[model samples]
Target chain A: MPHLDILKAAASSNQWMAIYPELLLGSLALVLLALEIILPKKQHAVIPSVAIIGQIGVLIWLAFNFHTVFLKPEHAYTFSGLLHHSEVGQFMRVFFLLASILVCVLGTIALAKQKMPRIEFFHIVLVVSAAMMLLAQSNNFILLFVALETVTVGFYILVSYFRTNPLSLEAGLKYLIMGALSSGLLLFGIVLLYGVAGNPTLPGSSANPMDFTALHTFLLANPNNFLASIGIVLVLSGVAFKIGAVPFQIWIPDVYQGAPTPVTAFLAVASKAAGFSLLLILTQNVFTPYEKLTTPVLAIMAAATILFGNLAALTQHNVKRLIGLSGVSHAGYLLIGVVAAGSQPLAIGAIYFYLFAYLLASFAVFGVMTHVAGGDDADQDLAHYSDLAKTHPFLGAVLAIGLGSLAGIPPLAGFMGKLLIFVAAFKAGLHVLLVVAIVGVVISIYYYFGWIKAAFFETWRAPLLEGETDLRPMCTPVGIMAGVALAMLALATVVLGCYQGAFGDWLLALKF
Target chain B: MADLIFYIFAAFTAGSALAVVLTKNTVAAALALLLCLVGVAGIFVLLDAFLLAALMVFVYAGAVVALFLFIVMLLDVQGGVRKPFKKATIVSSVFAFILLLLGLASFAHKGVQTTGDLGAAAPVGATLKSYGEQLFTTYLLPVQIVGFLLLIAMLGVIVLSKKFEGLEDIK
Candidate 1:
């Protein structure tokens, strides 16, 4: 009877205000659709600006009120324990919002070039980002799966938004299949964990086993349970697919190459960050008791992921594939941070810092790629950038800075990010992983510089046959909006690298 | 009698699942998947999870399999000729098979652990009213999120399939 009373009370007092940001985003998405229907054809161009400005408004509002609810010293359980809000969750909420704003900006630039229905793309992006915000804070399996699905399904559409290109459609199909398989694996793991945790005979068994705290208690009591270990591995495998670790990275190159540049960037940055966030929560909180098993598994995965990602990128001709593979190596480095977080509290901060650095650097590069890309978005190659610096010095500089940051060159945000992770790993005694990561970074530099070299220096080739003009698609001119966005990204990357400002200080001070 | 039914349904589900994978005809594979789902539903019924059984039949066996069949027939897929496995494919598949067998053997040997009898505990999803109450209360956020998921899925189908005309090259 008390349980019934509790349920009734929870139902009646579902505090909707705690998720005001998510609500605002979902409403903005709907408003875009409504505007698309009501407005005249010529006025539809204004809809994307509305979406972007509305998101910026939400971001500002969130920033102003960041400490209002869960910035307290402890975590707050809202939505009847479906959401666990903490400082990390708040940080990720802001991170996802910032990422989506950049995506919409890129979307506007990319969509303008293609003959596509533009409003739905922005709408889906808004909804997906909102879901990602929820996903970063989810405390229960049901909510986690639901929010993850929303993001994945939205990506399915965004990947194929450029449907005229066969490659885009192929990427969408591959993503759909791979996504479904990962979902199934994750669900299987969740079900197994639930069943085992709810067993009446088990010590510390929970009635509500899907709740992370309840499951954590059960896992704590049964540290060496066989079924729990299986579930843990399966869940990690599912997340591995999202972050593009070694064995699960087969779809990354193809999908990235085929997706429109903005969508590819979204996948490379936002989607991977979301995966790492989830992995961090699950490993550090729910399955922490099984570190005996998880540590070795993650260590092996990190080593292999770093090695494979670097080695594979060495031979790729396509720029998208190169970025995608390099993104895999980035995920590997973050995985090392996750492993280090088990012992070193600083690793969590390092992971967040790394993700932010990655976001700024990646958006800069992809922004440049978007302007440089022609009608056929999937056909960008290094050869197309033979004389990029000569033609567009502005874009070429942004590209260099972005690639430099990604390669962990000094005086860039990415270097500080990598240094933080390596320090965390060294403190945690993950010496072997640190060595592999350093080697990966060294290998990574060759390819990253190859891309830089492609832009800044022309490779000598046989003279073009008479009358065979260059067949490469003409690079689109950068708009004022895109130019400003790229400049902001490059500037932020440089600034964050040079100074551990208040933002960096706050991130480093965060605890799990 | 209940034990007999459980064994029968398990066999039926396993056999049909194998058929779904091995069958060459696309339509036959779809039908086999339906049977496999029905078998799962029957097993759920045996476990006193009537609500789950009903939902499985209604959702997966009823709607999803039907959609699969419709798409299969509408496309008039010849099921495509199967290509011979390459040397690498064969080697990798064999390796995977061995790994799978090892996993199954370990699971069979050590996966099951004894638990106290469950006769006293209330089954969470055994009835409709309680399930609805749970969905509206503690699980409300997930339900709303699922709403968005379905909405986007519907929008995805439309945006991906719809044809546009006289589109300008914006470049």
Candidate 2:
């Protein structure tokens, strides 16, 4: 009877409390829709400003009330989700919300500056951010499917926001087709899991729900269960496709190159961050019983993705495509933290911290790339960056900082992220992975600097750059984002390497 | 008597499912899928899930397939069938054969356990009352939230498909 009362109270309050993030974003989505409709076409800049402010408000709201409500044990924790919150959930939620807010700011100016339909772009982004918020909290496969598809539908539109651009349209179509296929695979996995655990007539335990906790217990009890193994494998495969895990990573570079630059940045950073966050939740919580297969599978995939992403990027001259591949390689390293799955405070903290680092570095790099090769950004080729140091020194320096950090050069956020991950991997006794990471970091140095060298070292016979080209400040948001990224990078270089103990412990204490 | 009813529906279910894959015209394939779904509903009835069986027929077969047909009409699927089966017939048959082998293996290994007594434990309506009670009490949050999300998804589809509130709230 008390359980009944507790359940009822939970159900009542969960409407406002458990799903606070989604509810907040839901309100934001509604406001955006209303504003998009009511606002005059010429004054569309107001729409993005409204959304940016609103999204930031949600982020602050999430941060301020973080551990008090969301971290509280009672109301927020309900349902059989693929993930639930601990300190890891809070960390991911805070960072993901922050990234999404940054993206909203970036998207506002980016689409407007490109002379695209600015209002609809903001609408889709807000709705998708809401879905992403739910995705980070999902502990059940059903919620996973629903949340992932919500985000995909938004991406399909956002990718083709430049409807007049054929490449954008093609990227949209490819994304839709391949995205639907991956969703199908994920659905199949969820349904098979349902088949395994949901049948009330399954004899021994008639208490099968899609709840992650019970499901984990059942799988652990029957560790050799073939059905459980198959379900977990398929789910992981679905997640791998989400994070651009190799063998399922074929669609990424095309999708990244073909979409609008801002959309690509979102896809590369926040979108991928959401994917990793979900992966952490699913593997660590739902499939904990089947860790044996999950670990080896992730290790093999991490190795393959890192190797393939790096190798493929070496040949790419297109700046966007190169960064796209770089995102894939970074996903591989994040998998090390995943493979090092234990109840360790430091390991999980490292993963979340690395995500924060990667997000800023990526945003800064791609933010600069919008004007990388041209003032008009005509060619977007590597050769265009030759003598960039002489022409657009600030842009070149910002790019170098972003790329250098990404390549894990010491004194940047990427290096700290990588170092933390390596330490975590070593602590987890992943000797081979630590070695591979070392070698991979070295390989990364060459490719990343190769671009840097072209930007600064090589001299071109071209005449003096035009004022419009050189003085645009890499478009409007580039300087601001560079500031954000550099500040973050500085933290990675100086603070994280030195003073991360308390912050890391606090991050580890987060509950989703 | 229930066993006979189950087997009859199961055969129809299997046959229609096969036809859905084998049919030539796209529309005909969709119709075959509808038939397959109906047969599945019949099997659900045999299992004594009165509400669920109704849902299988009304929601899945009626709504989902209808939506599929709506989309199929917009996209051309049957253009240039030119020698569709001649080259691939042998390969597809081999593939089908391998699938058959696997199907046989799965059923043989598992050895079907009769769910006959499961139905005897409770009648549909009586058990459903308890389920409803639990759903409203214990499983209430997921039920409500999924319902809300679905509402949002439906609203989204409407907003995208019917462009209202664009020009002074047009559409």
Candidate 3:
């Protein structure tokens, strides 16, 4: 009866408030699309500004609504349980908003150096960001599938934004094929789960099986169902692909290297964040009953992902490919947090903290890379970065600190993040995984420092031609904005590393 | 009579699906896919899901097939070349056969009940109306989200396919 009333009430316009952020962002995307059509080409520069401002406005709106949503976690289900409002969802929304703003800024800087359809880029990114936010809040399979596809479709274009680059086009095609395949797998999994859950006889029945709570109940009731196990495993594999885990890690390096640097940064941070959020939701809510079946599979994937990602990265000469491979390892570490969920009560918080730290450090490094590459793919070779410290000391320092943090140097955010993950793994009695993670970290330092060495100590190798000057980094406003973004991220990395307690306490307060 | 119609549609669906895979020319394959979609739509009609049947025809057979043909023509890829099957093809066929067997086995050994409550059985007209009502009410969020997904896809197409000044130079 209570659920029926919720369904009835959800049909009213009042339910609109539950999804105001998505609505606002969607409208903003449409508005940008209209502007793109109406505005003269010369005024295309204004589109990114509009996207950034609109995102900030949504962030402010989310902040104002946060307390109201946070206070009544019990009443968080809205749109008849399509969306869930929780502290974690709120945190993810903020994370996605901040990431979107940074991406928009980064994309603007990158677009300044290359001529393409700039307005559409901002709109598509905004749409994808909005979709990701919805994904974090999704409480049902239908929303999950749609949101995931929205993000994937948007990324297919963003990755190949530079169609002129054969590499970019190839990456886009590879991503499209793989992404479509994963989507098929995910849908098939959902169908299998749906069939097992049985079709709902009554509208909005507590037995409406796609609903998370209902699905949880069904799974608990029928834990030993073979079809359910297959369904869950299929779903997990699809998500693992999205997160760029091993065996599914084939596309990461190529896509990351081939995409425009800013888009690469977006994929690295926001796209991965969305995938991890969905994984968090699935593992925490849906698959909790089947932990025994899933845990071992996840552990093996984690170990393989860490080993392969780190070992392969050691030989990569392209900066984007290196970061992409290392990103796979980070996914492995994050999987550790996921595996520890049942055993460690604070594991979710640890995952959040780790993602937060990773976001800052990775974004800082990507921002510097975007600045140095200046929208050109040819400049991405590691050798091109040699002796950067001699000419651009500040840029060199940023790269050094960013890579150092990624390598888990002490007194940086990444170290604290790794420490939190390791502690959680230990508390969960995952000694083997903890050891493998440590080994992965040690292996990672070699290549991370290789980039650092190139940036700092290595002398410029190619002899200078007569009167040929090195290509000076662009000093445009977009370039300055990228620098500022990197500096702020670097500062946040250092501050978070130093004062871990504050963030830790805040995250711990977030009820899963 | 209904059983006869179901068998006919099923046969056509299977045949067209195989043709879709076996056809060497892209355009012919697309046409085979269209027939397969129509056959599936006919099967939906037999299942009493008239709305779904109609959508299968309109969306998949009509819109999607047309789009595929458009792309095939636009790319001008008219059976340019065909390569002989290689060792990789044999390996892939073996894997595909294994997967097909596994799927068949899983479906055959259904210990758990596959068909659950599918709502009160009603007349086809009422069922279609109720389906529309539920779509507009119960599943409104997903509908809106799908709308956004389509919009994003449209934007992606424009950005990737549209030729602009200086694009050729970069290529």
Candidate 4:
């Protein structure tokens, strides 16, 4: 009777504020859509500006209300446990907003160069960013599935935004098929888990079992249930597909190579962040009871992903494809955080820190790619980057720092992130994974440095065009804006690496 | 009598679903899909989910099947020709078989059940009302988010299909 009463009370209570950030972004998307219809095509530049402004506004709102989420424990479960408002969710919301702002800037630069519909591109980015924010707060299977699908479907359009490019279309088709298949697998897994949790024969089972806490209780009660194990593996496989882990990462290189550079950047950072957040949530909350069953699977996948991603990137000639392969290896490193999650308190913190560091470095590199490869898909070849320093010293420096961060070089955020992850794994006694990760890092340095060396040491040999005098002006307003964004990100990377102690402590203090 | 009706609908469902894949003519395949949807609706009625049955017939059979027919007719694809089966067919069939086995193994136990206490004893009318209540109250956020999803899809279709001013020369 008391349980029923509590359920009724929770259901009736209005906690709309828990979803305020999502609501703001969703409304902004609609507003942008309306403006797109009403405004003249000549005035389309305002759309990206408006999108960027809205994203910044959301970040400020998040900052103002951050304490409500972090300090108050009673506001955690809103919409009857559908959304969990916690410090981790708050942090991720800010992280996604930051990423969206950078992407909006990159998208604007890309849009100005290409002759595409500006409204749809910007508005869809807003919608997808909102979905990712909601994704970080989803505490139930229904919300998780819906939010994940929203992000995936939005990315499908963004990936193939260049409708005229056959390569982009091909990448879109591949992504759609694989995405649909993974969604089916994820849904099937949720159904199986729900069945086991809601089984009346099981003692202390709930009538409504999609909630994570309820599922956690059921899992703990029946830790060795055959059906649950299958469900866990299936769900993990779907997650692996999202994060571009080994076995399910076949689509990464093609999609990254074909997608618009800004979209590729979004996928590399924000989409991966969403996947890692969900994986962390699942491991810490629902799969803890079955840790004995799940950790080894994750460890093996992590090692294999690191090996495959790095080894394959050794031969890739395309810059985007190299980054794509390297992204797969980063997923492997993130998976180490997932494997050590059960035993190490700082594991999730390490994952988030690595993601933040990855975001800055990734966007900086992708931003340069966006400007450098303007209006030409053929310009992404690595050979084109020869003597970039001689032609564009500023961008050359940005690319070097970005690549260095990705390679986990010292005095950069990437190195600090990797150090935290390695320390966590070593503490958890994941010796084999730690060794494999170190080797993966070593292999990664070879390819990263290749790009750096090309930019710095190789000679520029391409003939100048009729109108181009000094390899084109790199000081236009758009160029200046992009340069400022990259410079800020590079500065943040160095600052975060130096201040890792304080940042990591703050992240680790948050309870899931 | 109910059992007899269930068997009839189930057989129709299986047969038409198979026909949907086996038949080469696109229009005929669309018609077969329509029949399969109707058969599934009939089965839903047998399970006493009257609301779901109506939705199945109206949405899937009426709207989606109509859309499929329109697309098939518009494309004017030449069909009824047997094409050589490729390696993809073999790979897909193997995966399909493995999925079938996994599904069967997961649901084979007598103790396995899909419905909980709330679904066990409800009459059709009461269940429908409660479903509405749940949808409006507990599931409101997902419902609204789905609205945004549809909006994004609409914008995507327009963006992909429309011919902008300067894009025609780029290809």
* Candidate lDDT values, in order: 0.92, 0.71, 0.84, 0.85
* Backbone clash total, candidate 3: 0
Candidate 3 DockQ, CA atoms: 0.47
Q: What stretches of model 1 exceed 4 Å from their correct place?
A: A1-8, A73-75, A461-468, B166-171
Give stretches of model 3 more than 4 Å off: A1-10, A37-42, A199-207, A467-478, B1-11, B70-76, B85-89, B92-96, B110-126, B165-171
C-alpha DockQ for predicted model 1:
0.66
- Report the candidate with higher lDDT, 2 versus 4: 4
Question: Lowest summed-lDDT stretch of 10 residues in model 2 chain A?
Answer: A371-380
In candidate 1, how many Å is residue A129 off? 0.5
Per-residue alpha-carbon lDDT of model 4 for A1-512, expressed as tens digits? 87576457656654777778878988898889888679866675677788888888889988888878523777678887888877888899999989888988988887766677777788898899999998998889999999999999999999999877787888888899999999998988898888788777776577678899899989988877878888898998898899999899999999988888889999999999999999989988888999988898999999999999999999998899999999999999999988987899888788888999999999988877776774565248776677678878888888888999999999899998999889989999999999999999999999999999887896656788788675432322436667789999988888887776776789866557
Please provide, for model 1 over B1-171, each residue's C-alpha lDDT reduced to its tens digit, 9 standing for 90 to 100: 989999999999999999999999999999999999999999998989999999999999999999999999999888788999999999999999999999999888878979877878988868998898888887888888888888888888888888766345222
- Sorted into a CAPRI-style docking class, model 4 comes out as acceptable
How far is B44's C-alpha from truth in model 3 (Å)? 1.7
Query: Which lDDT tens digits does candidate 1 get at residues A1-512?
Result: 88778687976556788899999999999899899789877788889999989999999999899987554544387877888888899899999998999999999988878888788899999999999999999889989999999999999999988999999999999999999999999999999899999998999999999999999999999988888889989989999999999889999999999998999999999999999999999989999999999988988999999999999999998999999999999999999999999999999999999999999999999998988888899999998888899999999999999999999999999999999999999999999999999999999999999999999997886688999887877777888878888999999999999998899889998976
Residue A505's lDDT within candidate 3 is: 96
Identify the candidate with maximal TM-score. Answer: 1
Q: After superposition, how far is residue A213 of candidate 3 from its true place, in Å?
A: 1.1
Residues A1-512, candidate 2: write the lDDT tens digits: 77677566745534446567767766776787787678766665577678777777877887787675545565446543333655566666677666666666556445544534455666667667767766777766656676777788778877766655677777888998988888877777776676666455553332444677677766666676666576778778888887898889999888887777778888887788888888877776667777777888999998888888888888888877888888888998998888885544476767887887787677767756665523232226676677777777776777787888799877776788888788878878888877777777788788899889988996545465666343323434345644564455444545554466777667645432
- DockQ, model 2, C-alpha based: 0.21
- Evaluate residue B104 in candidate 4 and report its C-alpha lDDT on the 0 to 100 scale: 79
